[model samples]
Target chain A: MRDVYVIGAGTTRFGELWERSFRDIGIEAGIKAINDSGITGNDIDALYIGNMSAGAFINQEHVGALIADYVGLAGSLHIPATRVEAAGASGALAFKEAYLSISSGMYDIVVVGGAEKMTDIGDEMANYITSMAIDQEWETVFGATYASLQAMMARAHMERYGTTREQLGMVSVINHRHGALNPDAQFQREIKLETVLKSGYVAEPLRVFDMAPLSDGAAALVLASGDVARKYTDRPVKVKAIGQASDTISLHDRREICTMDSTVYAAKRAYDMAGMGPEDIDVAEVYDSSTIAEIMAIEDLGFFPKGEGGKAVEDEKIALGGEIPINTSGGLKARGHPVGATGVAQIVEIVKQLRGDADRRQVKDAKIGLAHAVGGSGATAVVSILEAEI
Target chain B: MNMPRFWREKQGRYNLVGNRCTNCGTYYFPKRDICPKCHRKSIGKMEEVRFKGTGKVVSWTIVHDAHPDYKDMRPYIMAIIELEEGPRLTGQIVDCSLDEIHTGMRVRDTFRKLSEDGKDGVIFYGYKFRPVKE
Candidate 1:
C-alpha cells in the first residue's frame, strides 16, 4: 500500500446554523479544503460524503451527489460519490474509505467530508434522527434515547469506577476552556465545573450541560498519496493507522454498559497498527458527546487505566498544560456535535494540531495525534492515528 | 396495533429469556437462531431463565426531556441494570428519587406496562427495575 496523507482540512463553525442549507454548508467546507490544498476540482479523483440523518432530518437523501453537485464537481463527468453511514462514525468511515482508496493507488487524491443539517428540525425530530443508531428492535422500542443510553453507561461507570458527578463536570469545564479558544467551536465561552454540576438535570447524574447541543455544520478533508501530497502541501499529516470496531447494537445486549469494549478494541488496533500506544501521542481528540463519553474515551484509548478516566479529569491530567491535553477543540461537548460532521471535524482538529496551525489550542511540538469517534451507545467505534512523518 | 416480532415475544411468560451457545458461550438476549460465536444455526433451546431483576445499577440518567409520546415521562430515571446473567438491560427506575439512585445500587425488576400500543390496543408490558429494598 502507498502512504496516504492529509493535504488540507476545513470545517465551518459548528452550531445551530439556521440560515445555512445542508448543501451550502457542505460546499463551503469542500471549497475551503480544495482551496487550502491549492488544488482545483479537477485534481480530485473521487468523493466520499458522510451523513447520518439527512434522510430523516431534512427529508432528503442522495446527499453525496447533492454536495458534489453543489460544489460543481459533478458538472464535468465525475467519479461516483460514495455516501457512508455508520451512525456518528459516518464521517470517520468516509475518511477511512477515501484514505484507503488513495493508499491503495485506486485514487491519487480524494475528497472526504461530512455534513449535518440538524437545527432545521426541532429538537424532538433531531433526537429521533440521532436515535436511529440504536437497536430499533430492542432498545428504541423501550423509549431509549441516546441521552438515556449514555446515562445508563454513566451510572455503570460511576458504580464500577467511582466516577463522580464532579469529575464528569470537569470534562465539560476543560473542553469549554479549550473551546473558548476555538473560533469555529459551537460554544466559545468557558464553563465552570460548578456550572456543569449545578445545571438542571437532563438525565439523572447528567445535567443539561453534559450533552452536546443540536448543531448544523460540515467538515472536509483532502487526502492524497504520499507522492501527490508533497506537491500539494509542505506539511502533510500522515495517516498512520485507522481502525473500526463494533459491539452489540442494543445496549441491553452488551455484557457491560460501562466498558466500551468496541472503542477499546478499535483503539488497541489503531495503536498496534501505528506501532505506538496512547502515551506516544502528543495530543488527542475523543468523542465527547457528553462529559461522560469523553471520560470513557480517555480511558478506552489507554490515556488512563480502566475506570480512572474521570479521575484523570478531576486530577487535571486531561486539561490544557496538563499531562495530556485532550480535546483542544472543545470536543463534541462544547464544540457542538453535528453528528455526521463530528468525526471529520475531529480529524480536522488533529491535522491542524499536527501542522501547528491550531493557534491557541495548539499542543506544543505535537508529532502525533489520535481521534476516536463512537456511534450510538458505544456500538460502533473508529480510531485513527496521525503522525507528522512516515 | 400488532406488536413488533421482538416485542411480541415478551407477551409470553418466558420472561424474555436470552440464549447462549453452550459450545462457544456467546449469549443472546431474546434468543437467537444462530450462535454469533460459532455461527451454528443449530443453537441450544433458549432456557426459561428469570433474573431477580435484582442487579447493580450500572449507570443511569434522569431525562428531563423526552420524546413527545413521553412528555409526561420527563425527568424519569432511565437506567441500565447489569443482570447477573451478564446482559445489561435498559429500563426505567421507579419508586426512587433521582438522588437515591446511584451506580452499584441493587435493583429489583417490576413487570410493568411501558407504553400502550396506543389507547385501544395492546399494552406493551416490559421489565423496569426499582431500588431493591435493603
Candidate 2:
C-alpha cells in the first residue's frame, strides 16, 4: 500500500448545539474541510461518516446516506457512504478506513467525519444511547451503565495499582485547565483538584467532574494519497500508522480489568508500524472518556511506568510544556465528548498541533503525535500515529 | 426471572467462581471460552473460589444521574473492588455513606441486585462489598 496524508481538518465548536441538525452540522464541517483542502465536492472519491446511535438519538438511521445526500454528493457519483460504529472509536475507525483506502490507491481523496446531536433527545435518553457500548447481555442486561462500569474499573485500578483518587482528580484539573484555553471546548474553565475531589460522586471512584459532559458537535478530515497530498495543501500530516484492536465485549470476560489490554495492544501495534516508541511521540490525544480512562491510557500507551501514571500527572509531567504533553486540546474531560464526533475531533486537534495552528495548546517543536481512542470498558481501541513528514 | 434462582446461581455459590488459566495463571470472571492470557485452548476447568471479598477500592464514583428505567435509584455509589486474588469486580457499595469510601479502603463482599432489564426480565444479583469494619 502507498502512503496517506491528512491535508485538511475542520471541527465546529463542541457543546450543546441546540439549533443544528445532525446533517447540517456534518455538512458544515465537511464543507470547511473541503474548503481548507482546496478541493471541491467532485474531488472526493468516497465518504466515510462515523456516527453512533443516530437512530436512538435522532430517531434516524442510514446516516451515511443522509450525510452524502445533505452534502450534495449522492447522485452524481457513487459516493458510497460507509458508516463506522465501534462505540466511541467510531470516528477514529472511520478515519482509519478512509486513510487505508486512499493509501491503497482505491481513492484519491476521502472525506471523513462524525456528527452527533445528542442534546435533542434530552440527557436521560442520551444516557441510554451512550449505554449501548456496554455488554447488553450481562452488564447492561443487569441495568449497569457505563458510569457503573467505569466506577468498577476505577475501583479495581486503585486497588490493584494503588491508583489514588487524587491521581484520578489530577486528570480532571489538568484537562479543565487546558479546556479553559480551548475556544471550542464546552467546559472552558479551569477547576481545582480539590474541587474535583470534593465533587459529588457519579460512580464510586468517578466524580461528576471526572466525566465528560454530554456534547453535540461534528468534525471532519480530508485524506489524500501521499502522491496527491501536495496538490491539496503545502503542509500534509502524514498518516504513519493506524492500529486497532478489540477485547471481549463483556467486561467480565476480559483477562484483566486493571490493564486495558486493547489499548496496550493497539498502541503497541501503531508504534511498531510507525517505527517509533512513546519517547518519540511529542504530543498525544488520548481518550479520556472519564478521568480514570485518561490515566490508564497514559500507562497503557507507555508514556509512564505502570502505577506511576497518576503520580506523573501530579509532577506536572503531562502539562503543555512537560516531558510529554498530553491532551493539549482539553481532552474529552473538558473538550466535551460528542461520542461519534470525539475521535474525529481528536485527529483535528493533532493535525492543528502538527500544522502549528494551535496557539496556546501547541507543544513546542512537536514533530510526532498519537491519538488513542478506546471503546467501553477497554473492549475496543484504535491508535493512530501521525508524523509531520514521511 | 425468578430473583431467588438468579441470586442462588450467583451469590449462593459463595465462592466468586471464575475461570483460571492454568497455562498463564490468569483468572477470568464469568468464565471464558479460551484462556486470554496464554491464548491456549486447553484450559482447566476453573472452580468456584470464594474471595475474602476483602479488597481495596481501586476507584469509584457516585452516579447522580440514572437511566430512565433507574431514575428512582439516582445518586448511587458504584465501585471497582480489587480482590486480593488480583481480579477487579464492579458492584454497588452498601451499608456505607459516600463519605465513607476512600481509595485503598478495605472492603468485604455482599450481594445485591444491580438492575432489572424489565419487569418481566431477570433481576440480576451479584457480589458487592462494603468497608470491612475493624
Candidate 3:
C-alpha cells in the first residue's frame, strides 16, 4: 500500500449553530479544505460523508449525495459519494476509508467530510436518538439514557479504582481551560471544579457539566497519496498509522466496565503500525464526550495506568503545558460534540498544531500527534497517528 | 418498538430466557446466534436457557433527566445487573430508594411495565429488578 497524507483540514466552529443549515456548514468546511490544499474540485476523486442519525435528527437522509450535490461535485463532476455511519466515530471511520482507498491505489485523492446538526431537535429527543447507539432492545427499551450508560461506567470506575468526583470534575476543568483559548470551542470560558461538581445531576455521580452538549458543526479533510501531496501543500501531515476496533454494543457485555476495550485494542494496533509508543506522541486529541470518558481514554491509550487516569487529570498532567497535553482543542467536553464532526475536528486540531497554525492552544514544537474517537459507549474506536513532514 | 419486534422477543422479555453455548458453557442475554469466545466451534451448539433472574448490581445510575418517552419516570434507578447465570444486562431496579441502592446489592427480577406505545396503546411488560430484602 502507498502512503497517505492529510493535505489540508478545515472545520466550522462547533456550537448550537441555529442560523446555519446542515448543507451550508458542510459545503463551507469542504470548500475551505479544498482551497487550503490548493486543489480544484476536479482533483478530487471521491467524497465520503460521515453522519449519525441525520434521518432521525433532521428527518434527512442520503447525506453523501446531499453534500456532494450542494458542493457542486455530484452533478457536473458526478462524484461518487458514500455516507459512513458509526455512531460517534463516523468521521474517523470515514477518514479511515479515504486513507485506505488512497493507500490501496483505488483513489489518488479523496475528501472526507463529517457533519451533524443536532440542535434542530429538542434535548430529550436528541438524548433518545443518541441512546439508539446503545442496545435499544435491552438498554434503551428499559429506559437507559445516553448519560446513564456513561454514568454506569463512571460509577464502576469510582467503585473499582477510587476515582473521585473531584478528579472527574478536573477533566472538565482542564478541557475548559483549553477551550477558553480555542476560538472554535462551544464553551470558550473556563469552568471551576465546583461548577462541574455542583451542576444538577443528569445521572447520579454525573452532573450536567459532565456530559458534552449536543452540538452542530462540520469538519473536512483533504487526503492525497504521499507522491501527490507535496504538489499541493508543503507541510502535509503523514497518516502514519490508523487502527479501528469494535466491542460489544452493551456496556454490561464488556469484561472491564471502566475500560473501553475497543480503545485498548485500537490504540495497540495504531502504536504498532506507527512504530511509536504513547510516549512518542507529542500531542493528542481524544474523545471526551464526558469527563469520565476522557479519563478512560487516556488510560486505555497507554498514556497512564488503568486506574490513574483520575489522578492524571487532578494533577494537571493532561493540561496544555503538561505531559502529553491531551485535548488541546478542548475536546468534546468543551469543544462541543457534534458527533459526526468531532473525530475529523480532532485531526484538524492536530493538523494545526503540527503546522504551527494553532495560535493559543498549540502544543509547542509538536511533531507526532494521535487522535482517538469512540462510538456507542465503547463499542467502536478508531485511532490514527499523524506526523509532520519535517 | 413496533408490535412485531416486541412480539418476537416475548419469551426473553417475560422469562429472562437467554441462549447458552454448550461448548463454552457461556450464556448470552438478548440471545446470540454465535458464541464470540467459541466462534465457529459453538455454532449450532447453542441452547435456550432460562435465568433465575437473581443477581447483584455491578454498576448503576439514578437518572434525573430521562428520555421523552420516560419523562413520567424521572429520577429512576438503572443498573447493569450480573445474573447468576453469568451474563450481564441493563435493567431498572424498582421498589427501592436511591440511598438504599448500593453496588453489589442482591436483587431479583420482577415483571413490570417497561413502556407503552401510547396511553391506550400496547403496554409492554418486562422484567425489572427489585431488592432482595432477605
> What DockQ results do all the predictions give, each relative to the true complex?
0.57, 0.35, 0.91
How large is the i-RMS for each model, in angstroms? 2.2, 3.7, 0.7
User: How close is each model in CA RMSD to the real structure?
Assistant: 2.6, 4.2, 0.8
Leading candidate by DockQ: 3
Residues A80-147 of candidate 3: C-alpha lDDT, one tens digit per residue? 99999999999999999999889999999999999999999899889889888988888898999889
True contacts kept of each: 0.72, 0.55, 0.94
TM-scores, in order shown?
0.92, 0.85, 0.99
Q: A369 in model 1: Cα distance from truth in Å? A: 0.9
**Residue A224 CA error for candidate 3 (Å)?**
0.6
After superposition, the stretches of candidate 3 with alpha carbons farther than 4 Å from their true spots are none
Cα misplacement distance, residue B123 of candidate 2 (Å): 6.8
Calculate candidate 2's fnat: 0.55
TM-score of 3: 0.99
lDDT of 3 at B21: 98
| lDDT for A305 (candidate 2) | 92
Who wins the TM-score comparison? Answer: 3
Residue A252 accuracy (lDDT) in model 2: 55
lDDT of 3: 0.93
Which tens-of-lDDT digit does each residue in A317-339 have in candidate 2?
99888999899989998989989
Per the 3 Å backbone cut-off, how many clashing residue pairs does candidate 3 have? Answer: 0
TM-score, cand. 1 vs. native: 0.92
Q: Order the numbered candidates by lDDT, best leading.
A: 3, 1, 2
